[model samples]
Target: MTGEPSSMFEAIYAGAEAGEAKPPWDYGAPRPQLVEWAEARDLAGGGREALVVGCGYGADAEFLALLGFRTTGFDFAPTAIAAARRMYPASKVNYLVADVLDLPRKWQRRFDLVVESLTVQSMPPEQHTAAAQNIAALVAPEGTLLVLATTRDEGSEVKGPPWPLTRAELEEFASGGLILRGVERIESGTWWRAELSRGAGGSTSHARQF
Candidate 1:
């Protein structure tokens, strides 16, 4: 994973600098699955601190902000961060260019709600543990983390910069006292959304939705 994760995304977003092209996952709107979660009030972040990992173009972060969360979205790619700011002029989200492998210490266990969607799978399998741990570390005590990602059956083969995570890989995020509440497999098992929580506190009200 040496230099691969950071460079791959930064390069892809760089190609979209013209505004005519956007990363394949950037649909110009918040992801529908995430929107549904918010609309259902499954994720209620009223004035809570929220962090959006690998928030390319800021759609999800903006959506969380509108949900009344103090949201911060970050991408390792500078181009993506800049484009997000341009796209959401006067947005409440704090868009930043920061690395997942090396986040600021102040951010450790600082978010009441952390959203990680398809970001960990961007790295190679060798780095999945590190990526998951870093992401899990952002959840404050009793806080919740939502992970939405493409999934593949264990031992299945795939070729991708954005590789689909195996269940084993996804479970890595539950380390360090994080509880794996439930996992919802969607779209014929090709996609999954998982909910997790930290500390002795209970999971989110929508834990059953997972």
Candidate 2:
């Protein structure tokens, strides 16, 4: 999320344009965890607004839209947004180019559900705090924030475009009035899945799952 944002994303999309294989995180489908969550909840009511951060091909965003949420997916790369729109021409999801660290002011607390899947890990360590703050800021009061990221053991020396996040680092998202509802290690411990809510009153309402 730091550095010259355009340069970082331009180089990435440029590689894709050159016929290189898509990045590892570009799974070409909605993330399984998101699918599961959607199936478990009544999110298809057409009454909620959802935002997917760094939404590469907008698969997840499109999925949310299909399920009746007014979904918007954004990425730092304009190429990615264009590709997403083209890929899902019939999709109701709104695809746009936007930065997580410097989001539009009107978007502040505008979504009912904010999803950050693998986006935090894509940035350098120095940008994690700012990225977390900005991401949390997008959640409306009582909205849910779902995060899925690669996880690393404490003190592990892993070099990466995706510097795997530690458990403690993920907890930092709980700052700025977001309450941690739960954290789970999934996919054979390679990923950390967290669900947080924005509100002062504590409740365990999210414990239900299908």
Candidate 3:
């Protein structure tokens, strides 16, 4: 973690410039744990809009749209955005190319379900707070933020575009006024699903069939 690049932005941009195809992060299918969690929680039907960060290829965004949420998928890579638009055309999903740190301020408090699947941890360690804050800002008061990402095992070093988070790191990322509601592991525990609400109030939880 220490000697790794101080930020992922540079690497992402370099990949874009070099036209790197099939970045390891683009796993073809929507991450299963994320898909399963979203389907099970009825999060896609939540009243407000949803924003999918690091939406490479947009399989997750399409899935979210199919579940009835107005979805906005954004990535810094134009190639990825183009691919996403092509893949999800005629669907009600909006795909754009943008940096997560510089999103329009108007988007603040704009979403009910904010999906941060495999995104935050992809940034360098220095970016965790900013990523967390940005995700938190997008959640409307009384909205939910669903997080699905890989976590580092105990005593492991963090070096990555997929910089895995430890449970403590995950908790810290969600610390800015968002309360954790539920947690579950996926695929032999390589990934995790966490549902968080903006404030402390309704603790009720249930899964929705997709």
Q: Which candidate is the best by lDDT?
A: 1
For model 1 the TM-score comes to 0.90
Name the top TM-score candidate.
Answer: 1
Better of 1 and 2 by TM-score: 1
* Per-residue accuracy of model 2 over 1-210 as CA lDDT, tens digit each: 346656777667768878986766777889998888777675663568989999988989988888878999999988899889889888888899998888999998788788899888888888998898899888877788989998999899877677889998899888777778889898999999898887633333442221
User: By lDDT, is 1 or 3 better?
Assistant: 1
For candidate 3, write residues 9-45 as lDDT tens digits.
4455457548764466667878777776765655546
- Listed in order, each prediction's TM-score against the native is 0.90, 0.89, 0.80
Off by over 4 Å in 3: 1-21, 42-47, 200-210
- Candidate 3 clashing pairs, residues 3+ apart or interchain: 40-207, 40-208
Candidate 2 lDDT (Cα, 0 to 1): 0.83
Model 1: residues >4 Å from true position, as ranges? 1-3, 200-210
Worst 10 residues of 1 by lDDT: 201-210
Rank the candidate models, highest TM-score first: 1, 2, 3
Q: Rank the candidates by lDDT, best first.
A: 1, 2, 3
Ten-residue region with minimum lDDT total, candidate 2: 201-210
Give the range of the ten consecutive residues with the poorest summed lDDT in model 3.
201-210
How far is 9's C-alpha from truth in model 3 (Å)?
Answer: 8.1
TM-score of 2: 0.89
